[model samples]
Target: MVRKIFRVLLTILGVVTGFFVADSIINSNYIMNLGYFNNMVAKVSLYVFATLSFGIILFLLSPIFYKGVSKLTDAVEKSIGRLSASEIIFGAIGGIIALLIAALFILPINKLLPPKLEILGTVLSIIINTVAVVVGVDISVKRKDDIMALFEGWKKGSSKDKKGKVKGVAKVLDTSVIIDGRIFDICQTGFIEGPLVIPSFVLDELRHISDSSDGLKRNRGRRGLDILNKIQKELTIEVQIWEGDFPQIAEVDSKLLKLAQKLNGKVITNDYNLNKVAEFQGVSVLNINELSNAIKPVVLPGEDMNLTVVKDGKESGQGVAYLDDGTMIVVEGGRKFIGENINVTVTSVLQTAAGRMIFAKQKEV
Candidate 1:
């Protein structure tokens, strides 16, 4: 139904264009003095012929035009999908201002050109309008933060709090942190303040994962989605799904880093590689693994603790055990005691960027 209506509109536009063309030709005097017939009959015949021919051509080409229109719409939708609401609003405002400013000179410029060059003047006006709109939108999008800050400052009279500290910063969640699912607990504890921003690209990645063919990946993806729903519904803090994205950056981690820089926010993740990359880029990161290690019960050297040896370690005669918090402990000479609970003395503790590891020797009676 819509396609039929669109085709009819296109045919009407074609007929209107043909009428204008016929009028221009008739007024030019070249085709009117053909001496073929009376002026009135010639003019009427030309108008009818042009209108029918153009309308039929457009009606036949409607499908092709429709395809082009569909492609253009998809392209526009995809481009706009990457932008946040604020960006679109500011971009529209900027474009309107640009067009208004261009209107001031459009008439004067058209009048200055020779009558023969009227088409050139019209084309120039179109070019100027197009350039102005493009420049306006680009400028607005690039300086959105400054624009927003101006409005915010105007509204509040000041953005700083009574303590002189800047207001809250968004906590950007990455893919790994979402899947790890400890963030829910952290948010529940109220340690993480401010709005938690889940980037749209991150959500896309999660959806892809959830739909993965592999069972493990699919489960992880679903779990992440569940965790996100839980955070948004169960937690008091705001969980926003940010639509801002960087098309140039292919990697999710790179995109997250760029977003952090843009928003002046921190990236929260449990991925060690991402943590290092973010640190190198001078973007603050909150690593769940690091946080877990920090809050684990501190064990000092010579401290005695009971651990159940569940498996053998890589080294000969070594047994591996785990603390309640998942910290690994390597027990020396305890390989024979697999599946047995034994007392061990903490020999030393090793802390790395990854996590903490403890070496222990079996305590002797």
Candidate 2:
């Protein structure tokens, strides 16, 4: 019923538009000079022909146009529905400011213009307001912090009392660190005091991975889910499933960082690349790999440690041994002692975000 009404309105508008268009063409000096437009009968006939032609064309095409408009309307409505109250408030404030600024700019021009030039001022006012909207967006982006602060001041009397800390509120967990399973242990120890946020997008990725035909990915995904269950049921820290997602962001890691920024929280991850990206973006992150490295026992130079070389290192005649914590020890000239328990004196230690590497040689007999 609404669609039929819309089609009827469009056809009527088209008829009105066609009448004015034909009248203009006939009244114009250049067009009137044309042979066909010279006669009154031909001019009257053209008006009727154009009006009926335009109305028919519009009536035929209304369904397609209506579908497009309906789709666009739905998209906008959905987007607006997802916006928070603060965002809607900010948008309203910005629009009003833009209108006031445009009015101020045009008021002088409108006053200086002659009565006949009033339309000129009206056109300029429209153009200026269009520019003002763009200018408003740019200014808001540049002074976004100031605008947020102003709104916050209005909502809350004074911020002096509130430290404005979101640290304890949100703790975003990424896929890599969740699958690592150490985060559950850390949480069980009662170190993490706040709610752990697991985004819906990350959960979707895990579900996909868990359903993968690839055995390794499937296992890893299942393990991640199992760890999350443990963290929820076994640990005391609150686990929150964040339903919000950023469709504009493609990568899971990128979305994780964006979520952390929005929540004003820290990301917990073991992915080396993600760690670096989060640092570059100025988002706080707690790296599981780094934590593990920090807690590993420090092996001073000349300190004797017993190790059984399990494999050969990158260098020839260098035996590789791993600490229980997964720190690698490169034992020089100990290739012959492979699979044999031997004492080694640490020569040096190379510490990195990836892990720690200890360079040592077998101890003297």
Candidate 3:
């Protein structure tokens, strides 16, 4: 239906253009022969011919141009659909400002020039406008880090990026990593640097879990939100709430994988499943669990250590204890030693994709 309407419009436009073209060609000599109006009328005729000729050509090629523009628009929308609302808003503002500034410079030049030089002025103005729009978009994309840094400075007491180095990287946090909340500590330590991106969809999922009837899940979600708040308030990192998501992906793990790939950044996660999924997708991943496990004290088997058994383990007669870093230890035959600090000998180590576990027995002090 729309195509039919467009075809009808094209035919009307073509007929109007032909009339103008034929009229100008017929009246060309007559207009030139008239005294005092010769130069002015000649210019008018020239412009009219050019305009009509161009319009006619465009009408003839309308189908091709329409298809091309439709495709281009679709591609642009798809590409930009992943960006956050704030990002797109600011980018558009930047583009408009650039165009306005270009017009400020170019419009004056156009008005100051003589009538004969109008075409040249118009061409120059167009060049300026084109350059401005291109430069504006280019700056928006290329200087995303700088813009983020500026926002960071605004959030902080400072008004400048630290030494003008912009970190545009996005950090994708995982559930376990968020629950552990060492990322907040890591940010406070200033060891981890970059823009912190918490996908809004992830937050939504978190909220859902937090509101769940399950007490444990509710507690975990609340803890994660608290940690998120702490990071947002105290740290210099910009915590972005990314609403862009893949509806086709059922799980957050898969969504995280798709998002990391889209953003071209490392996934800051502790989930073994997510890490492996990200790796399979060729996306970089920063496993917080791996980092924690790596930084823990490397105690070999047969090494003796002092620990206080706090509670009973799942196995009968086994006492469980934790280190300062939260590494769990199962002390064999140490149930009697519960609530008392005692030395223990490391028995065996079990390593998994999640982390590490140690099985040990109580030793004489």
Best by TM-score: 1
TM-score of 1: 0.77
lDDT of 2 by residue, 1-365 (tens): 98999999999988988898888888888885776687778988989998998889898999998999999999989977765454556666776788898898789989999999888888998899988876775565445545664776676664453544333657999988888899988987867766699988889899998999999999999999999889888875667787656767889999999889887889999888998999999999898877887888878998999999999888889999998988889999989999999999999998775678899998889
* lDDT, candidates in the order shown: 0.89, 0.84, 0.79
User: What TM-score would every model get versus the actual structure?
Assistant: 0.77, 0.59, 0.52
Candidate 3 regions exceeding 4 Å error are 1-168, 210-219, 247-250, 309-320, 332-341, 361-365
Expressed as tens digits, the lDDT of each residue in 25-51 for candidate 1 is 887776657754356888899899888
Residue 321 Cα positional deviation in candidate 3, in Å, after optimal superposition: 4.0
Model 1, C-alpha of 27: deviation from truth (Å): 6.6
- Candidate 3, residues 220-283, lDDT tens digits: the string is 9999999988888888776777655666788888888777767777789877777777778798
Count the clashes in each prediction: 0, 0, 0
User: Model 3: clashing residue pairs?
Assistant: none
lDDT at position 130, candidate 1:
99
Poorest 10 consecutive residues by lDDT, candidate 3: 31-40
Ranked candidates (lDDT, high to low): 1, 2, 3
| Superposed Cα deviation of residue 365, candidate 1 (Å) | 4.6
Q: Alpha carbon lDDT of residue 281, candidate 2?
A: 100
What is the lDDT, from 0 to 100, of the residue 238 in candidate 2? 61
- Residue 104 Cα positional deviation in candidate 1, in Å, after optimal superposition: 4.8
What does the lDDT come to for candidate 1? Answer: 0.89
Off by over 4 Å in 1: 1-87, 104-125, 149-166, 307-312, 336-342
